[model samples]
Target: MADEKRRPRPAAQYGPTAALVARNVERLRKTRNLTIYSLSAELGKAGRPITPSAIAKIEKMQRQVNVDDLLALAVVFGVSPAALLLPLEDSPRHTAEITGAGAVPADSAWAWASNKRPLKFPPGEQRTAEMEYALASLPPNAREARQHPAGRAIEAAYEDVTRVIVRAAWSVEGDEHEFIDALDQARASLERTLAELGRLAVEHEELVRLRDGVPREGSD
Candidate 1:
């Protein structure tokens, strides 16, 4: 090994955030059951060939990560750049499904339905996972809707209502007694729409609070 490659200095030489990122990198690397040599090889495959000893120094917080190192680490871990930089608990998570479900606290009872990707999962599964992650990154109430500069929330609500209207009309066309069925469908849709609106309200309030740095009612 070259003299420069030797663990150059004590960990205290690096700032606290660098040490935190090092710990997170090590944790994520271990979660994939990768050894230091394997991780270095993976990095090399991604066009940045780092040595195992250097990786050891990184994991041990004996060396600070540069921009290139951070990007390479993100690729090796299969996560976004923010994942490497942010605290684990605050990182964006894949918690939503295709159903446009409500958000759950990341630490709550919700666990990813399929953490273990089968060795030979069909291509569809890969696409589905990617789609789900994209949805999960959005605010839950707006998962299927694109945001506009204005009236985005209204548009989402309109879509929900339109779906309900179509379903309700179909229910009544089948039979005379099916008016009750139409009413039931309408009621269900109304409930779902209300829930979405409630979510939208909360999200809007939170955004306002963040922008103004002011507290709103019942917000902690």
Candidate 2:
């Protein structure tokens, strides 16, 4: 029995998300004018190679994509992993069939997949404690920082600080003037950001109190 040849297992059936991923893979490959052979080569260069035959099987939905393959494909295609899981069409009227969520508006689906919004929230609805908690629970890098002015300010402050540090590290003795200018600019940027954050802190405290049904200070 040990010497006998092993038989191949049947292909596993995948859900709606897998089907969407497969479709996106095919569409992106064709859009970029890459053949299966070339895509396989690109994947190999990415260090997570999928054979040409397996690529065809994936496009045909004959094979399921594992997480590594998903990431490799995203790298080769120059798109975020979420992009490969979203529908190609992004019209608000069109719907994307998510496996667990049923049919969601294409725009909303994309927004949810990109972490820009919660999946269950309706448009124009006021933020609730639950929604706020959900957003807060996400990792810093995954939060929709670009959507809020304060968050963007924080990001700008971080970038300015990083730039100053990099400039300082690469500066020579004669580059003191340039380094000093960069340090001054970064300090100014941080001060502005600090002021913005102070204002936001007050606003955030009020929001938290409101969500928790606590009355404002000096309320009757």
Candidate 3:
């Protein structure tokens, strides 16, 4: 029984998410120019050692990735665990096969994996109280602010500005024109983000007033 448990199962027996993880692990390893041996070494340094043979089996979908393996791999690859579980392609037209969820749009799969949305909605297409509680239970960084559309726009704008600033700081000689253009773009993005923030602040204040039963200005 132990030998049978140790043996590699047929590909059909592996879950869809497991197959996706195997493919992504191999892809990310090759993209980073690391061999299985090197990845194994890195994993060992990360305190979750897997032999090269086991890593090879994992890449080939002959072995299952446990939760600890998933977390360790994410750390080694410098990515979130969701990145390994979801499809690399984010095209809405394409589909990803999830184990219990069956096939869902690739983008939706990514959103669900990243906690931007639920994997499946309740009947009537409304979020349940449990779902709301689950979302509320997330850390502040992982909650609605980061997942909401407006918040995402703000975050994206910040990233754009940060990217430009980094490029400018490390800019090579004779790249003045390119750096200036990037600075202009960053400035525009920052302005837009600021405007959005101001709008949200006003909206929040109004909500507070309403919740406190305060009358609107110039109203009876």
Candidate models: Cα lDDT each: 0.62, 0.81, 0.81
Q: Cα RMSD for candidate 1?
A: 18.0
Model 3 TM-score relative to the real fold:
0.62
- Candidate 1 lDDT for residue 119: 18
- Stretches > 4 Å off in candidate 2: 1-8, 122-126, 129-137, 141-220
**What's the lDDT for candidate 1?**
0.62
Query: Alpha carbon lDDT of residue 175, candidate 3?
Result: 61
lDDT of 2: 0.81
Pairs of residues clashing in candidate 1:
none
Assess every candidate by TM-score. Answer: 0.41, 0.60, 0.62
Look at candidate 3 and give me any clashing residue pairs.
none
* Candidate 3 residue-wise lDDT, 16-111, digit = tens: 888889999999999889999999999999999999999999998888899999999999999999889988876555899999989998866876
Model 2 per-residue lDDT at 80: 91
Model 1, 1-220: lDDT tens digits are 4665666545456654576578878989899999999999999999998899999998888777899989989888998775665445511233221122344333221223222111122566964663455465556554445333223445434445544555556566674455455556556656666677788788898898889989776868
Number of the top TM-score candidate: 3
> Which of the two candidates, 1 or 3, achieves a greater TM-score against the reference?
3
lDDT per residue as tens, model 2, 1-220: 9999899997788899999889999999998899999999999999998999999999999999999999999999999998789888765558999888999888668767765556675556636632574467667654555546676567567656766775686577466776788898889888888888898899999899999999978998
Tell me the deviation in Å of residue 196 in model 1: 12
Cα displacement (Å) at residue 9, model 3: 8.8
